[model samples]
Target: MSRDTIRADLCIIGAGAAGLVTSAGAAMLNRKVVLFEAREMGGDCLNFGCVPSKAILSAAHAAHTVRAAAKLGVNAGEPKIDFAAVMDHVRKAIADIEPNDSQDRFEGLGVRVIREWAHFTAPDTVESDSVTVKAKRFVIASGTRARIPSIPGLDTLPYLTNETIWQLDALPRHLFILGAGPIGCELGQAFARLGSDVTLVEAGTALGAFEPDHVAVLREALAADGVRLIEGTGVERFSGEAGAITAHLAGGETINASHVLVAAGREPVTDTLGLEAAGIEADARGIVCDDRLRTANRRVYAAGDIAGKGALTHLAGWHGSVILRNLYFGVPTRQSSNPIPACVYTSPGLAQIGLTEAKAREQYGGKVSVTSWPFHDNDRAIAEGDTAGGVKLVLGKGGKLLGVHVAGARSDDIAALAAITMAKGGTVRDLTGPVLAYPTRGEAIKRAAGKHFEPVVFGPFAKAWAGLLSALH
Candidate 1:
């Protein structure tokens, strides 16, 4: 293969969420940029992950809503899902978002696009099949792929990962999913709503990273939706033929299903990147980087899943901003210190920001106070008949908001408000000051914050003071 050497101000590997944003920003700033991607232009997010998954979830949610309307005086009968049409919807969503991340788009933005796999050849250089990039700075955004566990018969059995799950022509009669993380839970609930009998198996607790109370809410919802939740158990092995598969559990139980979807986890795509050639240090997790997203080689930075910071699309975009500011304006910002919000896009979406309750209790001991406001108490929730979950806020001394976990309708949107408040070092008072429109889910946030100050506002001393003031009046 003939290799042509090229030079640029920045060379970004992988055109996923992080790489695309970083490349565009750098190019718009008049810096010469080169972007390399071996596969799809938009990386895993647009091609196989978030875009398709969310599209499927939307369809499933529609199906579920139709069935749920009976409780609200309207009777929308059971939904008949055409699995092929649903997959088409997922594809159409990807097609709609594809142009924004295409090679032509980036090229028009003054970026030199290289469609090839890239690996480091030297401390300051990386090369692909037809081109070599020697840049002043390099950004690695290789992302990750589904981590397939070593189940005894997994290799021999026909299984689906996120990459291949969308390709199904017909819905499985019974869908068995491994892992209970965000992806597993989201897809499990989606398939169940789409009329598939879903059984989700997790080696550990379901939604283990989320607040336990919030997880309980989602667990109940998933069960109500016909998704069988199997927690605290691992798959001992697999058996059965192509049409029928059997997962033997550790506790001597077996689950038979038509299809098995593996959502266990993801592994970073760094094995073939030749990090050793460039002295870039990485572990099993991903490339090692400082809070500033810089690798051992100061000229190189890692972003997105490959950075080991967080495997979230939003976080990947944030990494792009951090890289641009540091490279162009000489500003040092730590990605870790920034308030990162995460949400599981299920019905009554689970969203969280900053420290969890357990983390807060561990860090501050008894100095922290945990306050909650149930959706049942929210007037909007009562009216909508969607009052399944609530909000939990962890507050420190002087009402400093340590964290916020919400599980209810539109919790993702509510968490965004909390993220902004936390970013600005605001407290519960700020949340309560805003007079949110009545009969809206947003009111739940304000109500939750109000609970934090209930003791002080309705205390005996305040009551006495109010009585005296009334007498004087």
Candidate 2:
């Protein structure tokens, strides 16, 4: 069969978050656009990773709330979880948001949506089974997939990755998850809370990227949620089948579980993109790109996880804007100039941005000041009886807000307040100026900032002035 050749102003591979934004925005700019997808729309985020994980967490949160209601003098004794219903909710959540990223929607925007895997045949030409596309520019937004580690006998049995876990018809009696990073931790807690016996085995420290103190709080919360955590060790191998499985750890201990999942990490989807043919540099971390998100081939750009940047849906959209400005506005946008926030949704969620206290102190030494406030001191947390976590503020010599970490209810949202201030080059003082609403978790940010300035604001000079004013009176 003869292949149809189409030409366009822009050709985007992978109809994920980054590609969707680039396609939609370029279409609005009246540029001829062609988009390709190997699988579902909305990428792994809507179809697998973020959306479904959060939906399950939302279901688990309800179960937790019912269990905790007794503390508030309401007896919501032992909630019964309808596992199928919970999965239904997860599907509905995906379905509800599906149309926004649907192929029909992009086609409506005048984007030529190709439902085929695209590979580069030439520097400027991409071809699939039925058609070939030649465009002035190309944007690669093909995201990542769960990275499955090679362990002995792992492939001998059926296992679940983030991509396939949503098909779970019934909850695992005892779910064995490898890796305790954000995804592993979140899924472990969610399943345990929803009445599944869950165990998480990690080769490294759990949530090793976050500050030790903040990670401690999250670890404790995971334990309270009934997640059995095995850290600093790895699964030696796996044996048995889908329903009956055994995990042998490095230390010679074996765990029998009903199901196994590999949440170890994500691998960028680039093996099929024909990067070598196009001279684009890439590796295990994804495609190597500059701060402007340009690949070795100037004619091509990559965004989202595929850009070698860490996975964050918000950041992917930002990357699209950067490309737009560079391509059309000649604005010379840089992706790393602004600090990005990383958040984990594990019970009292964890959110962190910029430098950690240890990093700031190592860099600035005496120039750094650390201020922390526990949620126990915050009336809102006390009222709600969830006073497990707190907030930490890191500052530099000139009172510059270096970083902020929060582990409490709405901690991610609370970090937004500090993010805005930091993004504008504002100091901790900027965080303190606003009169945050009472009985809210966000007060923690302002409270921590106020603590950072307490001594200077109410010290001997102010006291001496107060006394001198009294004498004058």
Q: Give me the candidate number with maximum lDDT.
A: 1
Candidate 2 lDDT over 1-473, as tens digits, reads 77999999999998888999999999999999999997998998899988999999999999999999999999989999999999999999999999999999999999999999999988899999999999999999999988889999899988998988899999889999999999999999999999999999999899887888988888888888888898999888899887999999998999999999899988898889998888888988999999999998988999998988789988888888889989977788898867789999988889999889888888988899899899999999999999988999999977898889999788989899988888899998888899888988888888888998889889999889989999999
lDDT of 2: 0.91
lDDT at 8 for candidate 2? 95
Clashing pairs for predicted structure model 2, backbone only: none
Question: What shift in Å separates residue 215 of candidate 1 from its native position after superposition?
Answer: 0.5
Overall lDDT per candidate, in order of appearance: 0.92, 0.91
Spell out the clash pairs found in candidate 1. none
- Candidate 2 residues lying further than 4 Å off, grouped into runs, are none
